[model samples]
Target: MPKPSGRGAADSSYAAGTGIAGRGVLLDVGRYKGSDGPDDSWLPLDANPLEEAEPDAAITLDDLKATADAQGVRLREHDILLIRTGAIERTQDPNAEWDPFGEPGLTYSDDLIEWVHEMDIPYIGADNLAVEQIFQTVTEDDLGEGRKSLHGNYALPLHGAFLRDLGVSLNEVLDLSELAAQCAEDGIYEFLFTAAPLNFEMGTGGPVNPVVLKATDGAGEEGGSEGRRGRGR
Candidate 1:
């Protein structure tokens, strides 16, 4: 796990405004990867080829923007971005190989970092264990002379970039299949999202069950409590 450079939600002061409720957009990368196959397909998360592939197979920021545009969804400041990468679906397969050290996720690059900063979203969640691809190949040249000593050190760089630098909280290992199905059925991508984490003092992180509320009439209401309800993994 990555350490926070500053105070986190675990602090007493941070707990006051920890509960976030606002508009959320679900970017179903699984659909972009053809996981549905014209029919609702549910497979183990690791079984998904996109999630099991290497960093080269990771989704890019432009892919997300294009998908959002195609789905008629707009990215706004402070929106909670829920990315469905089909990671939870992998749990259905009992014989799947589990690799804690590696998993498929969003591509980690300066462009992605810049995009996130520009979007100004407070929280970003993904169905995968990590928000960015793990064990990415980094050469000594890639690290440059000053940072060459750190080459080959496995780390969650995105976590440090987002949580530490940008003050963005990352939610991972979410089961987004149900939410994705609901969004597809209604052709609605935005919804009222809220997450309440355990108030562990001085804790770096804790568990959270994110609640997603979508309006029955297809008009998303911010902070609205009534509608179809879905929980996080």
Candidate 2:
């Protein structure tokens, strides 16, 4: 790793001119690619069964490109990307046995990093924490506790690529179900987005509740949960 750089949550801390702000693009991958096509239009019925592998699946660059084409949404530079995988949704059922060690999400890829860098995407987030999948596949290999994220371990390479190398910020664990519903109904995937952490100097990370203000025929809507997900420095 690159030495012990003290770039904690304080770096991108919600300061006056700093925090994250820009067009937010929602790529509901869980719907279009992560699951069995859209159920009646972009989301499976709440009462219906959730998509399997919400536990272990990779949202690859190919899936990303296909989602954009399916939504008819154009990718914009400097855009804040929020990918909804519905992985979290699967675990919502209290009766289901769930393990947090590994779950489905975006995995690392050289091409993806290149695309993010080239597009200058300032931030990327998802419904799952760790944004990048810790377990690369369906069968989670127990890499001994805490050893999975050890320095030099390729488990969470994107964490290093985007945050460490390209200086792109990352945030996660957002409740994007409501947001997904809104987008599918309106067919508008772009909106004004902003988020920031409570500035606690030198803190590793802090909680953030992203705000979304949408413009739809002069009407507006806001959807998000007050959740705790640390933001990268």
Candidate 3:
């Protein structure tokens, strides 16, 4: 296949047959208001849905930093940030609608992208099907006259900016409940993370089972009894 038109084309570091290893931080936005339940509008007619849990809320860069601070974890370079919005958990319910097109996820904005770049993190993953909310209405007026719609002009603008511009790889539809549970139980947010992509030559994307390892000792400590691996979906 022809090379994709973005940073991914130039950056061969995360290509298939390669492995990415680094410290990881799980930012649990799953239980955050408006993220715990499915949207009624997207549910099937016969499907009985759960009650609306809470009001809608968007996670900002500040929220990420605050959550890390509260967990006594520091964001550092090469950290693989995993954001859990609890969208995956809802899909596990037989009655819940798994609408890939419309779902709650990180609010995409220029500031958010800048924040990620400033952190110097190499990769990011999310529990939602897409890392950002989809199906956004962009009208001709929104584009403005004569200005061509760029790759970053879509609803999931970060996909283009991160993969194509910044050479960042995005992992989506990850199940993070177990990882979040482990983080909460152990009071540890940082872990040794490793993920290897399928060895497909010239492939754009493939499946991956990312793992997060935490030391048995305790949170923030280096040495521990043993390292336990938390498997991702």
Candidate 4:
């Protein structure tokens, strides 16, 4: 190997920890509330499915709850929450024009941030560019008395809420199509999720390969853990 460089060598870092393994809970918001079918009763009754009117939507905490309820999943503390908004899938299509701005996914809210903290969720992942909306929405509280501004104060609030303040790690741009389809097919949303990030202790962020181990019946229809690739920019 060449001489060691910079501050450190043979070392790297990720938020909270270097690697993560946990009881992964997937809330497939795309399949549950996308521009598809409610084909069965499991679909949330009040799901504002992806459509023309709200192409640039932001999934609220209620949306997450409704999705979880529809999928029969009870959110637990320390559970790895992986949400699929289908944003990654759109990027794969040749004709589709994927716009990162105002993309539909989790956005910052008082209740949403509070719930994440109160639940003690250590990590969160999503199939979007940012786990939260890339273009954040501002409110009156952020505006204050004068036109003081929202550019900095309200831009991607979740970044500060989760990463800065809560110390929660966020994995974004995940290719969740395969996992979502598989989970929807078998009706099993919980799995053993494990990931080992490239060791870069000095760096605040690094890439990881997330693998999902799903339990199948003795019939052996499904085999073992499926390594889902992380979608790159």
Candidate 5:
């Protein structure tokens, strides 16, 4: 059951056409030892306006860029960009400062969004409560809602609106660090990826488990049966 690469889960082309078989590379964004959390080396909760009880320790954007560059893989356009924030690891603990429902750390900035947009990446995902830190904020002058119900609430407002309201989708909390590392080691970051969303017609969103398969290389011999899961889509 090999799939196609260079497209997102909702890319109509993949859904309507034939599939490919290559070396599967899982770009997981879950927590790992080398991950770097949000910048918290400065003020504490008492001093900082944003109420953060503690600092997050997860992977940074630099780590991801370096890893991808070293592997010589040009992050595929329309491919799933899995980011490991280590937030999910913390979420497992009841006493964790960051709440899954509330605001979260490890969000994407405008620069990151610009980069993704330039790359033509249709789908970007993270292994945290949000793809962009919920505490972070972004502006959308194009829309009527500006600087209201957005700041420090849902990380990047423009990003969410662009992804969701604009028809693009963001997959969140898909334990992907180990898988990303494996792909890093193999120097194969692109592969045929397939994710079956819950298919909730009435519901706005649902969970999805995506599987990556290698088609060009002989690595993913087992086919499209192997992969991972996402909490929300």
Candidate 6:
């Protein structure tokens, strides 16, 4: 079916299960100070997750790769890589919980995109308002002493151009806590999943409520591969 654009939804073809699953890990990339103190983890709506985060503190690339390697699973070529930075976890209002992560993990940059290309990662999804964090602040430990910049806020560049313009797809605001736990227990980081995109032809982004269904064994359908692909660069 031809995908709609402007103001529509993606074709609702894979609204159900795909049957291939063993274990899946949820890497919560959300940013919080991880302190017992009062949760001073609030950031403005436009905060960036990369500014000065400790690599060991949040779900870094190494961690995700390690989890996937240990699972004896190959990430589905077109699977939605859900990234939860935990920003929305702090929001009290469900409707206003678009803030994805607090201040640690941001989305991929151009270099990160090159890494993605090298890794053959199909897609990226997040639970934050934007793919990156809102604030662009760095802590003392993030650098040494007087380093000016560590990581630039290149999320939109990666998303809008690399992913969007370069034909890769990105899904935002995915709830992956349970999925993360499931992967930890079963040692499976890949699953036969499906997501229906909002087919808004003229729209820049669409509202998507993706459901990550748990499958048993390769009930994976050869269907639904179309949405997995995008129409950019």
The candidate that achieves the highest lDDT relative to the unseen native structure: 4
The C-alpha local distance difference test score for the whole of candidate 6 amounts to 0.44
Ranking by lDDT: 4, 2, 1, 3, 5, 6
Residue 121 C-alpha lDDT in model 5: 59
What TM-score does candidate 5 reach?
0.58
lDDT of 1 by residue, 1-233 (tens): 99656344434225324586889898887676544323433212233333344432366777689769877888887888888766566554565445545455665556677778988877888877776666454446444447666655345677777877887777788878777877776778898887776665565666777777776445562433322222221
Q: Flag regions of model 6 displaced more than 4 Å.
A: 1-60, 70-77, 92-102, 107-109, 135-155, 216-233
Candidate 5, residue 88: the lDDT equals 56
When sorted by TM-score, best at the front, the candidate numbers are 4, 2, 1, 3, 5, 6
Q: Write the per-residue lDDT of candidate 2 for residues 61-175, one digit (tens) a residue.
A: 7778888889999997898888887756655756543455445677655668788999998888787767777644312232334545532324677777787688776777777
lDDT of all predictions: 0.64, 0.65, 0.60, 0.67, 0.48, 0.44
Error of 3 at 59 (Å): 2.9
What TM-score goes with each of the models? 0.73, 0.74, 0.71, 0.78, 0.58, 0.54
What residue runs in model 3 are displaced by over 4 Å at the alpha carbon?
1-14, 32-57, 136-153, 217-233
Clashes (backbone N, CA, C under 3 Å), per candidate, total 5, 0, 3, 5, 22, 36
Better-scoring candidate (lDDT), 2 or 4: 4
Query: Candidate 3: TM-score?
Result: 0.71
Report lDDT (Cα) of residue 14, candidate 1: 54
Question: lDDT tens string, model 4, 1-233?
Answer: 88645324222254325467899988887776676223321211112322222532567788888888998988888898998877766677565445666467776666677788888987788987778766554555434356445434244678777876787777888888777777777777889988776665455556777888888553646745565666211
What's the C-alpha lDDT at position 17 in model 4? 59
The 10 consecutive residues of candidate 3 with the worst lDDT sum are 41-50
Best-fitting candidate, scored by TM-score: 4
The model with the greater TM-score, 2 or 3, is 2
Report the candidate with higher lDDT, 3 versus 6.
3
